[model samples]
Target: MSFQGEQYPGVKAPAAETDGFRLNHTMLRIKDPQAALDFYSRVFGMQVLRRLDFEEMQFSLYFLAKLEAGDEVPEDKARRSVWTFSQKGLLELTHNWGTEDQADFAYHDGNAEPQGFGHICFSVPDLDAAEAWFDANEVEFIKRSDQGKMPDVVFVKDVDGYWIEVVEAARMADKGD
Candidate 1:
């Protein structure tokens, strides 16, 4: 069945939320800094928020995310040709130039799945619209099964092959009122 939050539509939309403390970002280990930066910037439109270079370590980290107008992106961020806005969810890229033995892993590749680790999910107002957008953009969903009475939910991989779950929230809107 669909999930219907009591205040979904009838009431004024849920008040904008402030998560007590500001969330900093998410860090990812990438092989090629330039390639990874290009992929996220070109495909997702995420701006580079910041960068930290460790000369001794020979590694560079790039922080990219959505940005709002007038947001001040540090000068270092410009070095990567990426920018960030005042938005949530920042993607941090860790690039090590001298390290060659590091093991590579995807978000879903490890067993024990570990606590504090899970798939990122997006709630869509309309599943049909989402599916259409995915089709138009040539995005593929990995596991999409919704034939039964339960609500429709699908899992898809991001550009980096990270699993993301997309759930349909609008179906519940038709149940009442």
Candidate 2:
């Protein structure tokens, strides 16, 4: 069955959503996005639906739903736009964005020949304390937050030479205060 309570090979068009619509997902090249295609996903007796993204949303998960004869789902009405930002960063990883689905990963690592990639960031509860912790642990610093014109922003180099940015949201408030 479909989201609109249609039967198998359902010929009727999706109902004009009154509440809203969800973007569910978008895929490129030789692919189409619709309930018609969505229904066909059950070829494998698919109870699980995989939402696609060219980039990130959940960023680490493919939201799936069971497509059986009867299963309820979010009522999409406004031409599909609800599934925009997913539960963000449940499984944050050290890899390039938008390539999570692929097996082989190619990276620029923010340096060397094919250079473009930069760094990942982390927010700490205490910026000064975190910096002190880094120094205490002998972490290699490209620049401490105090050294840069962009104060309160710390840059530390990992063993792999990739830079990691550390920030504290409270610092913005600190400046304002």
Candidate 3:
């Protein structure tokens, strides 16, 4: 028998209150920080919230977060160590000089699964519009020829060779119920 579905025959579910942990952000290693910043901004509508520079180490890191409706914090406030307000989820971008040799440019492929870790997914208001934007912007996406029946999904790569997934918000809302 395949260990796909029966791997945990008697696995017990967690408590109702302990459903799952909140997703922080996927950290990516990129060669060119500026290029990665431009890609995310143009394709995914993500904005750079804060930037931390390590001048001595010849490396810099940027924190990016999707600008959701009613989610706007002044840049000065975010630059500080901590703010009185809550922090929105952000994607951490790491750029290290001479560290690009360790970066992976190809899509991740694990085991017999055709799809690898894939990419960090975000639920958007409309998939069609987003897809169009990606196409117009010349973003490359992997074809899901045999991934079975799945919802509308598009893939884009960041400057550091990481894939990002985009999903529809309407479908996500239905799944909540």
- Candidate with the greatest TM-score versus the true structure: 3
Candidate 2: which stretches are off by over 4 Å? 1-87, 90-108, 112-114, 173-177
Sort the predicted structures by lDDT, highest score first: 3, 1, 2
lDDT by residue for model 1 (94-131), tens? 87774334456333322234645556565666676766
lDDT of 2 by residue, 1-177 (tens): 445564667466666773454444322111112322332232212232334444533232243332435534445623222322332222112222445345463434565676766665667778888788778656778878888677898888653455667889977665642
Model with the higher lDDT, candidate 2 or 3: 3
26-124 in candidate 3: lDDT tens per residue?
667667776788898877788877777899988887878777688546657544434312354678778876664545543233212575565677777
- Per-model CA lDDT versus the true structure: 0.61, 0.49, 0.65
- Worst lDDT run of 10 residues, candidate 3, spans 103-112
- lDDT assessment of candidate 2: 0.49
Q: Work out candidate 1's RMSD over C-alphas.
A: 8.0
RMSD of each: 8.0, 17.2, 7.1
lDDT of 3 at 166: 74
Q: For model 3, name the residue pairs that clash.
A: none
Model 1 stretches astray by more than 4 angstroms: 1-20, 69-88, 98-116, 122-140, 145-152, 167-177
Looking at model 1, report the run of 10 residues with the lowest lDDT sum.
104-113
Higher-scoring candidate on TM-score, 1 or 3: 3
